[model samples]
Target chain A: MMLEFIQHLVNGLSLGSIYALIALGYTMVFGVLQLINFAHGDVYMLGAYIGMYTAHFFQLGQNSSVLALIFTITVSMITCAVVGFLIEKFAYRPLRKSPRINVLITAIGVSLFLEFSGQLLFGPDPKFFPQIFKPSGDWSIGELKINPLQILVFFISIILMSVLQTIIFKTRLGRAMRAVSFNHDLASLMGIPTHRIISYTFMLGSGLAGAAGVLVGLTYPKIDPLMGTMPGLKAFVAAVLGGIGNITGAVIGAMTLGLAEEFLVGYWAPTYRDALAFGILILILLFKPTGLFGVKQTEKV
Target chain B: MKLLFSSNSRHGIASLRNWILALVLIWMAHFFVADEIDPYFFSIIMYAGINIILAVSLNVVNGFSGQFSMGHAGFMSVGGYISAFATTQLETIYPEWFAHSFLMSLFFIFILVLAGLGAGFVGILVGLPSLRLKGDYLAIVTLGFGEIIRVFILNIDTIGGARGLPNIPALSSFGLLYSWVVITIFCIWRLVNSAQGRDFLAVREDEIAAEAMGVNTTQAKVRAFVVGAFFAGVAGALFAHYLRYLNPQTFDFNRSFEIIIMVVLGGMGSLTGSVLAAVFLTAIREALRSLQELTRIDFRMIIYSLMLILLMLTRPNGLLGTRELIDFIPNGSRKKKKSLESHP
Candidate 1:
C-alpha cells in the first residue's frame, strides 16, 4: 500500500510540475495584460505539434539523445514565441482601448480560431508523439519505483521555473514587465516602452507553455488538436487557485491540484475526477475571492 | 383613484388584445409553414425560435444586468434532460391514446414549466455565490458552474451518460416553439421595461453606485440569472422535443458561446435586436451549409470565430446598440423625449 501511494505521488508530482509550467503562462499573461489570453493553451498545442514535426523531420526516434530533445524543445519554443507575438500584435493589441468584456470575447475568438485552425491543419485524429529516446522501464528503489521520465519532468520544470524567477526578479526586462503589468499607462510614461514589454511578456509566457507542451508530449506520448483544452482549463484553475497574477502562488496551486487529482482518482470516485478542479474553484471563489496569495485591492470611489 | 383604475384596466385590455392578435398571426404562420414550406425550412424556423429564446434570455443577465454568464447552455441541458426524462417516463405510463390527446399537450407544457423552474432553482444556487463576484471573475465562476453541471450529467448512467438521453417524444411544433418564444420575449420585454428593470440597468452600469443608491444589486443579478435560466429551460424543453434527442455534448460550452454570439451581435439590451440577431445568425448558418458541403471541411466555425473577433473590433456594441427596431422608426416626439431623458 505504501509503495502504491509512493508511485501515485511520483506520478502526481510529475503531472503537477507540467501544470505548474502551463499555469505560469496564464499567471504571467494575466499579470502583464490583465487578459486571460485564452489562446495560450492552443499555442501550447501548436508547440507540441511543432515538436512532433521537428522530431519526425530529423528522424530522432532511433537515438535517445538529450541534445536532440533539447533541439526539438528549443525549436518548438521559438516557433511558439513567434506565434504568440503575432497573436498579440493582431488580435489583442487592437482591443487595448476597448471594454474588458470585448477583449475577453476577442480572446475567446482567438482561442477558437487557433483550435479550429489546428483541427484543419493537423486533422482531428490523434497522432503519436515520436519517442525521442530509447523506451525504458521504471527505476525501482526496493519496493517504490520511479520513472526516469518523471524525474526528468520534475528537473526540467524546476530549472525552467528558476530561470523564470530570475527573469522576473533579477533582470531589467523582467523589471519592465512588472512595471507594465503594474500600470500600463504609468509604465509607458516612465519610458518603459509598454507595448514592447507586453509583447515580450507574451513571448516569454508562451515559450514556457511551449516547453510544457513538449514535456507533456514526452510523458503522455500522444498529441491531438483538442488535447490542450482540458489541461489548459485545469492549469487555469491552478492559476486562479494560486492567485492569478502571483507567480509562486501559481506553482503551488498547480502542485496542490495535481496531487489532489491523483489522490482522488486513485482512492475516490474516478468518474468525478474532472469535476474536482472546478469544485475547488467554486469553493475558493466563494470563500476567498482573492486567492491564496493574492493581495486584496479595494476599489476606490 | 377611480380614474387611475379605469385607465389601468383600459391599458391592460389593449395589451391583452395585442397578445391575442400576435398569437393568432403566429398560429396562421405556423399552419402556412407546416402545410406549405419544406420541413427543412420549418426546422430552421424552429431552431431560430429556440435561439431567439436563448439570446433574449441571456441578454437579461449579460445585457441589462451587466453580468457575464457563459453557462446558459448548462441550464438548457438541465431543462432538456429533466423534460426528456419526464416525457419518456410519462409516455410509458400513459396509453397511446393519451399521446395524441389535448390533455397530453397541457401535460407537456406543465413539464416544460417544471423544467424551467428546476433550472431557475439551479440558477439561484449558482448565482447566489457568484453574484458577489465582479466582471471576469463572475464569468469564470459561471463558466465553471456550467462545466461542473456537464461533467456531473456525463456521469449519470440512467440518463444514458456519455451516450446521452435519447428517444424523447416530438411534442413540439412550430406554433408551440414560437408561442413560447413570443411568451418569453413578451415577459422579458415587460420585465425590462418595468420599474424593476431599472435596478437591473443600475447594477449593469455600476454595481457600487447601484448599491449606494439603495439598489439590492445581488437580488437584481440573481433575478437576471433566474429569468434567463428559466427561459433557457423552456427553450431547452422545446428543443429536446423538436429533435427527439438529448446529448450532453449538445449543451457544451460551444453551444453557450453560440448563444452568446447571438446576444452580443444583437444590441445586448434590445429585445427586438436579440430576435433579429437570432434570425439573422441562423440564416447565415444555413447559408454557410452549402459552402460547407462544397469544401467538405467545417469552415463554418472558422468564419464564425472570425466574425466575432471582427465584430468586437469594429462594432462592439453590435447591430442596434441597445435600441429596438421600433426605435428606428421616425418618431420625432419619442426620439426627442428619449434623448432628453438620457442626457438629463
Candidate 2:
C-alpha cells in the first residue's frame, strides 16, 4: 500500500508540473489583462501539433537523441509564441475598450475558431505523437516502478519554471510586465509601452503552454484537436484556485489539483475525475472568492 | 406585481384579441405544416421553434437582467431528461393506448411544465449562490455548474450514461410546439413591459443603485433565473420529444453557446430580435449544410465562430440594439407610450 502511494505521488507530481505550466499562462494573462484568454489551451494543442510535425520533419522519431527533442520543443515554443502573438493582436486587442462580457464572448469565439480550424487543418482523427525520446524502461524501488520519462518531465518543467521566474522577477522587461499588470493606464502613463508589454506577456505565457503541450505529448503520445479543452479548463480552475492573478498561487493550485485528480483516479471512481476540479472551483469560489493566495480588492461603486 | 391580464381595459382587450387571433392562425397553420410541408422542412421549422424558446429564455437572464449565464444548456438538459424519462415511463405504463389522443397531449404539456419547474429548481440552486458574483466570475461559475451537470449526467447509468436516454415519445405537433414559442414570447414581453420588469431593467443597469432604490436586487436576479431556466426547460422538453432521443452530448456547452449566439445576434433584451435571430441562424445553418457535405469538412462551425468574432468586433449591439421590431414602425403603441410618458 505504501509503495502504491509513493508511486501515485510521483506520478501526480509529474502531472502537476504540466498543469502548473499551463496554469501559469492563465494566471499571467489574467493578471495583466483581467481577461481569461480562452484560446490559450488551443495554443497548447497547436504546440503539440507543431512538435509532432517538427519531429517528423527532422526524422527524429527512430533513434531519438536529447538534442533532437530539445530542437523540437524549441521550434514548438517559437511557433506557438507567434501564434499567441497573433491571437492577442487580432482577437483581443480590438476589444480592449469593450465591455468585459464582449471580450469574454470574443475569447470564446477565438477558442472555437482555433478548435474548429485545427480540426480542419489537422484532421479530426487523433494522431500519435512521434516518440522523439523514449526511455529504455522503468526502474523499480521496492514495489514502486519509476519511469525515466516522469523524471524527465519533472526536471524539464523545473528548468522552464525557473527560467520563467528569472524572467518575471530578475529582468527589466519583467519589471515592465509587472508594472503593466499593476495598472494598464498608469503603466502606459509611465511610458511602459503597455500594448507591447501585454503582447509580450501573451507570447510568454503561450510559450509556456506550448512547452506543456509538448511535454504532455511526450508523456501520453496522443494528440487531437479537442484534447486541449478539458486540460485547459482544469488549468483555469487551477489558476482560480491559486488566486487568479497570483503567479506562485497558480503553481501551488495546479499541484494541489493534479495531486487530487491523480489520487481520485488511483483510488476512487475514475469517471468522477473530470468533475473534481469544477467541484473544487465551486467550493473555493463560495468559501474564499479571492483564492488561496489572491489579494482582494473592494468593488468601486 | 399583479401583471396578469393588464388592468387597463382597452389595452387588455387589444392584447386579448391579438392572442385569440394568434391562436386561431397557429391552429390553422398546423394542418398545412402537418400535411403539405416536407418532413425535412418541418423538422427545421421545429428546430427553429426550439431555438427561439432557448434564445428568448436566455435573453431573460443575460440580456434583460444583465447577468452573464453560460449554463442555460444545463437547465435545458435537466428539463429534457426529466420530460423524456416521464414520457417513456408513461408510454410503458399505457403501451400506446393514448399515443395520439388528446389525453396524451394534455399529459405531455403537464410533463413539459413539470420539466420546466424541475429546471427552475436547479436554477435556484445554481443562481442563488453565484448571482451575487460579478460578471466574469459569475460566467465561470455558471460554466462550471453546466460542466458539473453534464458530468453527472454522463455518470448516471440509468439515464443511459454517455450513450444517452432514448425512446422518448414524440408528442410534438406544429400547433403544440409553436404555441409554446408564442406563449414564451408573450409572457416574457409582458414581464418586460410591466412595472416589475423595470426592477429587472433597473437591476441590470445598475444593481447597487437599484438596491438603493428599494429593489430587492437578489430577488429580482433570482426571479429572472427561475423564469429563464423554466422556459429553457420547457424548450428542452419539447426538443426531447421532437428528437425522440436525449443525448447528453446534445446539451453540452456547444449547445449553450449556440443559444447565446442567438441571443447576442438578436440584440439582447429584444424578444422579437431573439425570434428573428433564431430563425435566421437556423436557416443559415441549413443553407450551409450542403456546403459541409460537399467539402466533406465541417466549415459551418468555423464560419459561425468567425461570424461571432466579427459580430462582437463590429456590432456588439446586434441587429436591434435592445429595441423591438415593432418599435421601428411609425406610430407603434410602445413607442407612442414612451413618448407620452416622457411628455407627461
| Superposed Cα deviation of residue A172, candidate 2 (Å) | 1.0
Which digits, one per residue and each the tens of the lDDT, describe model 1 over residues B196-233? Answer: 78888888777788899999988898999999999999
Off by over 4 Å in 2: B7-14, B96-100, B293-296, B336-344
lDDT of each: 0.85, 0.88
Query: For model 1, what is the alpha-carbon lDDT of residue A251?
Result: 97
lDDT of 1 by residue, A157-194 (tens): 99999999999999999999999888888999999998
Across B1-344, the per-residue lDDT of candidate 2 in tens digits comes to 45756644444323766876787789899966577999999889999999999999999998888898999999999999999888888788988756557888888889999999999999999999988887778888888898889889999988889998888888988899999998898788878777777888888778898999999999999999999999999999999999999888887787888888888888877788999999999998888889777765567678778978998899886677677787777665353434211100
Model 2 alpha-carbon miss at residue B66, Å:
1.2
Q: List per-candidate RMSD values in Å.
A: 3.0, 2.7
How would you encode candidate 2's per-residue C-alpha lDDT over A1-301 as one tens digit per residue? 8887888888898889889989999999999999988888899999999999999998999979888888988999999999999999998999898888888889888888999899899988899999999888898876678988888988898899889889999999899999998999899999999999999999999999999999999999999988888888889999999999888899899999999999999999888888899899889998998999999988788
lDDT of 1 at A202: 92
**Maximum-TM-score candidate:** 2
